[model samples]
Target chain A: MEITINQTPFKLPQGASIAEAIEIFGAEPPYAIALNLTFVHRQRYGETFLTQGDALEIVQPVAGG
Target chain B: MSLPENPDPLVLYGTSFPSRLLLGTAQYPSPEVLRQAVEVSGPSFLTVSLRRQAAGHNETGGQAFWDLLSTLKIPFLPNTAGCHTPEEVWTTAQMAREVFETPWIKLELIGDDYTLQPDTLEMVGVAERLLKDGFKVLPYCTEDLVLCRRLVDIGCEAIMPWAAPIGTGRGALNPYALRLLRERLTVPMLIDAGIGRPSHACEVMEWGFDGVLLNTAVAKAADPIRLAGAFKKAIEAGREAFLGGAMTQRETAAASTPILGTPFWHQNPS
Candidate 1:
């Protein structure tokens, strides 16, 4: 499946859950995930399935003052 | 003079803030925890900064944070903290408007690298441009009465005077100047930066500041959520006290007793 994550497209295995995509991208655990403008809860990521053209955004907090 | 059943509403640039506490979205242990702390703080205004990711580096995933903020349905006050020039600040403000779809910006133009102080000249310049562009400019500046007046003259909607250097945690260093600014400035005045604790925020409110903007003080606390709530309560109490008008103090004897000592049974006849 072709998915756009943070404006960049990437190929993922068919019927892949968000959890698998995170691991596939080697994303860190402490990051937050948003799929299609909605935040997917951490506990629900393993069950939340993704499809083609899904917009995924993974955000990590940075030091700011 | 009494505390209202609900918090008083503070309106800035057309948005109404029930709680005078403005929170920063930074330095939390995690985004989840930051959201929790923001909830605990009960802030109507949240501050976020704009910065470019490294060159050609595209994937920041910053949308998740924005998603949460949208869900919260609170007014987001995007800040120009890192910008040092008027052009940079103006550009960042435009980007923020593009991304957040809001014209409200916390304009911060740092002058020196060491202290991270605001450049009064650049701040005035950018503020004039932003105001003319219809952006609500909340300039983060020093406690200079003249500079503040200049910003107001240039059409800034609000003035956010720093208590001290950014993230210094030194708390309010110039209470007198802050008090004067609060009294003098016609628009809303928020004491931003160098607030280390809830008490500091309370003190600023008690000194008649219109609002408080703090990030590191709550986000870096041992218990971020709890401390956020603490600050919320403290600011409320302080504002209440300020409106209630605290009793005056006396340096010398101006008491019930006269200068001459009264006899033991002097009041018996009365």
Candidate 2:
């Protein structure tokens, strides 16, 4: 199945967990992810499952004013 | 003669800040420069944001930036930089709270791309949602009176109105409106963005604004560190001036010397 992470396409196994998607997406520690425009807590990453074309956003800290 | 330091500390969401200047962790040439600028400015609070991680790229400078921010020890404010809608802002704010573990958020809801102006209509709604979720919201808005009043009405304890558009560096675009806000709103008001120089920050402080937040002026300067120190001192000076009670301006000239101590060149000679 194909899932979109940060607008990038990635092929992952069906019923892939959010944690596994993070691993395949190369998101490092100290980052946050949103599945389908809603926040996914770190503790629930294991339970959150992703399907094809799921929009997952992995974001990190950056400069702001 | 220098006066005694002002004892008033800026209290936002129950936290007290000794320094009234808030630095932005953006536009610096490097992470080291941003760190040094924060060091000299002595700002108690700073602003940061969250960005989507680039594809197949983890070295997008997030870790190093976080590392530097950690060492600086300044409380970083997470903002919804490009979020156009309340839902976008809400989602981003939630993620930021988890990532930084801070309930404080600088909510930036842009309505127009050209001006990057904040969405006044939706600002209150966004703030209300965040406040309900126990997040301390400091909304970045224009120098509009009724909008600010509504934000206050919606239970925002602190509000940040732009001095000008973000990154314009024009400084205090509307003094009258800003003054009115300072007069009407009892809650903490921070002049954020469009500060071009130290004097700009000082002027806002002198006007009794609780604090000033800036990024481009200091970060884009030739000597960011020195400018940061200058801003720090200016804000302090302005705060002192406000506490000292500025004298009202006069239309006619007035003599500082008493007539009893007049010299030979006094009115008698004339």
Clashing residue pairs in candidate 2 (N, C-alpha, C atoms within 3 angstroms): none
Candidate of highest TM-score: 2
The 10-residue segment with the lowest total lDDT in model 1 chain A: A56-65
List runs of model 1 lying over 4 Å from the truth. Answer: A1-65, B1-7, B54-61, B252-270
The per-model DockQ list reads 0.07, 0.80
Instruction: Estimate, for each residue in B1-270, the C-alpha lDDT of model 2 and write its tens digit.
Output: 985664788999898887899998888887778878988988968898999877443332477777777899888788899999899999999999998999999999999999999999999998999999999999999989999999999989999999988888898989999999899999999998889989999999999998999899999999999999999999999989998999999999998978675667554844
lDDT of each residue in A1-65, candidate 1, tens digit only: 99977667879999999999887776653355667755566778899999999988665433234
Window of ten residues with lowest summed lDDT in model 2 chain B? B53-62
Q: Which ten residues in a row have the lowest lDDT in candidate 1 chain B?
A: B52-61
Across B1-270, the per-residue lDDT of candidate 1 in tens digits comes to 976555567778766668898888887878788888888888868887654322232222244555666677777788877777787677667666655667888898989999998998777987998899899889899999999999888787778999988888788999888888888877888888999888888889888888898898888889999999999999998898999998888888766867476676477766
Q: How does chain A of every candidate compare to the true chain A by TM-score? A: 0.91, 0.96
For model 2, report the TM-score of its A chain: 0.96
**Could you list the chain B TM-scores for each candidate?**
0.88, 0.93
